[model samples]
Target: MLEHLDRMEAHLRELLEKEGGWLPFERFMHEALYAPGLGYYTAGSRKLATPTDSAGSSDFITAPELSPWFGATLSTPVADVLRDTNSLDVLEVGAGTGALAASLLPALAELGLPVNYYILEVSADLRERQQQTLAAWEPQVRWLDRLPERFRGCVLGNELLDAMPVRLFCWSQELEVLERGVVWHDHGWTWHDVPADSALSRIVRERMPPLPGYLSEVNLQAEGWMHGLGDWLEAGAALLIDYGFPQHEYYHPQRHRGTLMCHFRHQASDDPLKLVGLQDITAHIDFTAMADAAHASGLEVLGYTSQAAFLLDAGLLEHLQSLRESDAHAYVLQLNSVQKLIQESEMGELFKVLAVGREAAVPRGFRRDRLHSL
Candidate 1:
């Protein structure tokens, strides 16, 4: 890890020296995640995930680590999706540390839902580690490089859409989309406006309603991913859980710069260029655009709700009671996890949960009665 970091530092030094004193934020981000040797995710370094939590850990924490309650809540929806069917196959994208999978498998197992869990993880190191953590559930577990042609149960993703590469755009006063580009200028890396030539423009114009803003981020990759998921599902449903806002709030003129941030050792910062390949960069997902893509792909947007609402409807309290009555210490730990997930100031409000399904007999438990379709 240290060696790769050193090599990356040297490469960055050379690039900066030749071009300017700094690199564009995107370039820095690319190096951080995909750099050959020492970049955060791609590098041989152990920066992102490890056996134990230690100092200088990769930035950012997802709900899975917060508690088993989230997994319990997730199961309700999965079970609901698979209610009429006995055989269930779940494909989970980006199983960070495999926490959700670890918790969810047992929860569903208790519910008598025999599940074949398929984890599609991109990181080699994380995949190997996940194999060990999930070793006990051997017969039912299968690792995949991608989603299969047809699946019955559910395709679930948590905190995934935000990480997809996005195209930055600024809407001019004329309401035209202008592409944001990076250039080596003024002895440093700088941002400049360029003509929008990407195919994303057509989709954005057609699906994304006009917003009166010049500076914003566009996640074309996310839309593509949605289309792919819908196509691959072929039979079942897709559940996307991520931190984001509805269209109105996300594209409001007041936002100005859009949602983009970096996490380093649990500290959040604005400058993604500060520490290349050593931190996590993420943007808040735009749920509206995602739904639009799903609809276009022939998938019905079944429900969209806040994480809190989704969990409560899914019987979070029922699961909590069952655990609490079983053991006092375990109940306390579970409560702490629930608090992190449902509290107003935490992931509860910020994270939006959307479920898209095809030919489902009924709306899942998470979307049972009070679901608001967006």
Candidate 2:
């Protein structure tokens, strides 16, 4: 890992030197996560858990990694989309370690709906891990190197939008909007802000007007992902669940440091420049921006809600009830994990679920309909 990080730093330096000593944060993040084999996700770091998983063995555990019940609970809404759209395909983007797919496939099959599960993963290491994890269900599973020209049925991603490369814009007291960038400093990389560029400037000026000293993330990649889906998805919905807030709260006065976060060995910090390719860097999703992009692209906003509400409404408790009480060890474990899944103090409120669909009803978890918040 040290050697990998050394090489990665050199690579980043080369990128910086080539781009006139300043590279946009989004481009840097793209390289950090997807720079051939040197980037974090592409480098095959052990980012998931297993039976013998250590406390600091991985960067952080996602909801699906915490419990199969996460995916089992999700099957409810997915099944609804499947039945409603009368489609049989499900596309999962950025399928980390394939835990969700491994759990969701059998759950969906048992419900009399054997889905043609497609994973659009970029990491060769993770693809191999997913392959091993889902070996038993290979017949129903496949991989896609790129987004399909057209897609039907449900497209889903858990904690995905947050991972996409985002353009950062800062609204300062001077009423100037600047684009965030990176450059080399004293023995390390650091921030190098430049004048805001293009539509990003326009969007910040219009959407975040008069916000003195506000720093936040805006994911044009998320918007583009949804826009592409809107163009190709003849039916069904895009179900995206991640940790984020709507636009208003996202750019609030108190958030001067922005939402950028980096995870290393299960600990999260408010820095993205330190470890570079050794940790996972992300920003909270701006759901309002995403929803607006989807709407502009012709996709209808079906539903949006907190993860707790989505799971409860989608029958998480029912799935829990079906567990065997006789298996005290397994039952206790699941019980604890389920609490973390639903408890607001944990991932419950911090993470939210957004569903953008066509011909699909308000998704089960979002039956309460919180699009107004976005």
What is the lDDT of every predicted structure here?
0.74, 0.87
Off by over 4 Å in 2: 50-52, 325-329
Local accuracy of candidate 1 as per-residue lDDT tens digits, 1-374? 45555676677667757765545444555666766656666554444433246756656667876676788778887887877443488889988778889889999999898798999887777788779889999798899996677777788899878877677776666767667655556443457666565564664565455565656677777888898777877667778899988777787667777888888787888766556667777889888889888989988887888888788888889888887788879888667658878888998889888888787654454544324434
Q: What CA root-mean-square deviation does each model show from the true structure?
A: 3.7, 1.5
lDDT of 1: 0.74
Q: List the residue pairs that clash in candidate 2.
A: 59-266, 310-365
lDDT for each residue of candidate 2 in 1-374, tens digit (9 for 90 to 100): 67887999999888888899999999999998889888888887887665358789888888998889999988999998998989999999999999999889978988999899999998899999999999999998999999888888999999888889999878767878889888899998888888897778888776765676677878888888877778888889988999998998888778777899989998999888877888899999888988888888888988889999999999998887777555667777778888898899999998998889787877678766688899
Name model 1 segments beyond 4 Å from true: 1-6, 9-31, 44-56, 172-176, 185-188, 198-213, 365-373
lDDT, residue 338, model 1 = 82
Q: After superposition, how far is residue 22 of candidate 2 from its true place, in Å?
A: 0.8
What TM-score does candidate 2 reach? 0.96
Error of 2 at 247 (Å): 0.7
Error of 2 at 205 (Å): 1.3
